[model samples]
Target: MAEAGEGRYEIASVISRSFETVRSNLGLFAGLALILSGVPAFALNLWQTSFGVNLNAAQPDFSALLSAAYLGPLFVGWLVAMVTNAVLQASLTRATVTHLSGEKPVFAQCLTVGVSMILPMIGIGILLALGVGLAMLLLIVPGIILWLCWSVVVPVYVQEKVGVIEAFGRSMALTEGSRWRIFLTMLLVLVGLWLLSIPVGLLTVAVAATGSVIAVSLVTAIVSALGSMVMVTVQSCVYVELRNVKEGVAPADLEAIFA
Candidate 1:
C-alpha cells in the first residue's frame, strides 16, 4: 500500500501486519512451532550435551568431536530439523493466508497441507540453501540478492501447488519490483530479533552453568520455537502482500483456491 508506484509495498505495513498475524494467532503458532521445532531441537541439544564435548574450550578434542557417534546423530538431527522447519513454514503459511482471508484457520487443515507439501518444501529448501550458500561463498551481495528474490518460495509452492523450480521462478517474479523494500524489512526484523536474543542468550548461559542440560536445552528450544513462529509468519505475510501488489490477488481470492 505504497503510493510511490504500482507493485510497491510499504515496509511498515508488511512488518506491522506480520507481527499482528503472529499476535492474533499466538496459541496456534506457538503450538505448531513447539511440536515441529521445539521438540526436535530439545532432543538434538540433549544428544549433543551428552557427548560432553566442550566446543568452547581452546584446543578442544577434535578427535572426540569428529567421531562417528558424534557425527551420525548430528547429521540425523540436522536433517530432522530441516524437514520439521519446512513443515512449520508450510503450516504457518496456510494459517496466515486463511487468517488474512477473514476465515478462521483450522489447525488440522493447516497441518495437513503442511504434511502433504513436505517433499516439495524440502526440495525447495535444499536448493535455496545450496544456491544462496554458494553465492555467499563467492560474494555476500549475490547471496543477499538471491535470498531476497527467493524469500517467498515456500509460500509460493504451498499456495500455488507449483513444481519446485516453478516456485522459485514465481517467487522471483513476485519479488521483482520490491526487493529493496523487502531487504529493509528483513534487516529490521533480524535486528530486532538479535536485540531480543541478548537477554535470552544470557539466560541460556546461566542455565548451562548450573549443570542442568535439560533445563538449558528446554529454554533454548522454546526460544527457537518462538523465533521460528515469528519468522515464518513474517514470510507468509510477505507472500500475501507481494501477491496483492503484483498480481492484484486479494486474500479472499487466495482463500477460494483452497476451497
Candidate 2:
C-alpha cells in the first residue's frame, strides 16, 4: 500500500512537470494526420464527380446518391479514427508524461489506451449514427445536439477505461468543468485545419483522373490521419489532467503509473 501510494505521487508529479512536451509532440503527429485525412474523402468525392461526368454528360445530378455513397464510408472511417484516436492520444499523453519524467512507454501503449475506449466509442458511433439517421427523418438540430453532447465520449472511455455506460457518465462529468474550453478549442482548430486543407481539397476533382489526384490523395490522407491523431493526443493530455483532478494523486503518483 505504501509503495502504491508513493507510485501515484510519482505519477502525479511527473504529469505536473511534463505539460509542455505533451503539447509539442501531439501537435507534430496530429498535423501530419490531418493532412492525410483529406485523401480517401477526396478520392471518393472525385470518383463521384467522375461518375457524374460519365452518367449523362448534362451536368447530371447525383448529389443525393453521392452523399449516401461517399459519406457513409467516410463516417465509418471517421468513427474508427475517433475510437482509435482516444487510445492513441491517451498513449501519446502518457508517453510524453513518462518521457518528461525520464521513463519509457511503448509506442503500443497508445493502442491499449485506444482499445479500452472501444465500447464507449462504439456507443458514441451508434448514437451519432442514430442521430444522423433521425436527422434524415427530422431536421438536423437534434442530431447536432446529441453529437455535441457526446463529443467527449472517446476521451471518457480512454482516460477512465470505462465501458460505454460509464463512459457516457464520465464524458458528461469531465466535460462539465472543461467542455466549453475544449469545444471552443476544437472549433478553432477545425476551422484552421479546414483553411489549411482548402488548397488540397480543391485539387481533388481538378486533378481527378490524373496520377496527381492519387498522389495528392495519399498525401492528404496521411496528413489528415496525423492531424486526427494529434488532436486526440492533445485531448488525451487534457483528459489525464482531468483524471488526476478526480483521482487526487500527488506529483509522484503519476510517475509511478507511467513507470
Highest lDDT scorer = 1
Clash count (model 1, backbone only): 0
Superposed Cα deviation of residue 50, candidate 1 (Å): 1.7
Give the poorly placed runs of model 2, Cα more than 4 Å off.
1-58, 61-105, 112-120, 128-149, 199-211, 244-259
Clashes of 2: 40
* Deviation of model 2 at 106, angstroms: 2.6
Residues 1-259 of candidate 1: C-alpha lDDT, one tens digit per residue = 2445556687887899888888888889899999999999999988898788988998888999889999999999999998899899999999998898887888899999899888888999899999999999999999999999999998888888888999999998888878888998888998999999999999999998999989998999999999989888888888988988877888678978746
Tens-digit lDDT string for candidate 2 (52-125): 33455566556754676666866776665555544444455555445444555455554465455555555666
TM values, all candidates? 0.95, 0.57
Whole-model Cα lDDT per candidate? 0.89, 0.52
RMSD of 1: 2.0
Question: Which candidate number has the best TM-score?
Answer: 1
Worst 10 residues of 1 by lDDT: 1-10
